[model samples]
Target: MPGRNDEDNKPVAVTTSLFMHPASSPHAKTVFWGMLATRPDRRGEKIALLLGAQAIVHMWEKEGARGFMTGVRQDNASSAALCNRLGISDTDWTYSVCIDPEMLGRKNLTK
Candidate 1:
């Protein structure tokens, strides 16, 4: 799948709100590298690299970012490698999401 369509033109990838760190946090100016996944057949084309670099650079210039960071699962070697290739470093920090296991796949609307 080339994942390109002049017909529908829907977005294939999304950048999420996880990148929005709190202003009060010490790492406020740090840019979170939001990674995009290409189709399995499209891997190694460095498409992720191009998009990531653009997003990172835009944030750096627009927000005056002091550093860049991202959250990748410890088991995700590919993502970690991309992070490194983009000139970002991994931290000892752990990212956790608190949600009830039973609530998964259900509409848990919480403000």
Candidate 2:
């Protein structure tokens, strides 16, 4: 739904916990979920990248967060382009590992 917003048509705040690692740093930081939604009415890769960049800027302002970390499957060109626009260079290193397989299981245990 292009150009559609919730009743108010205003931007929604999106965030998620993401693991981080630097080449020289020994530890990682955990921030909230990164936003991944459309802007007002734009389309295609440009819009996606704009939204992605805006989300990071928003979080940094609101929560004092440092950076962002997001991933897309190998073939998700749109998302890949968006990430690229975020100025994320170098595909290196690893981050936190899921501790509980059940957390990612099919069943919605919390429900």
Best by TM-score: 1
Q: How many clashes show up per model? A: 0, 6
TM-score of each: 0.66, 0.49
lDDT of 1: 0.61
Clashing pairs in 1: none
Task: Please provide, for model 2 over 29-111, each residue's C-alpha lDDT reduced to its tens digit, 9 standing for 90 to 100.
Answer: 42433335554344443544545565566666765556556655566666566567676543664555465767666632110
What clash pairs does model 2 have? 15-33, 16-32, 16-33, 16-34, 17-32, 17-33
Model 2 reaches what TM-score against the true structure?
0.49
Ten residues in a row with the worst lDDT in model 1? 10-19
Winning model by lDDT: 1
Cα deviation at 56, candidate 2, in Å, is: 0.6
Could you tell me which 10 consecutive residues in candidate 2 have the lowest summed lDDT?
26-35
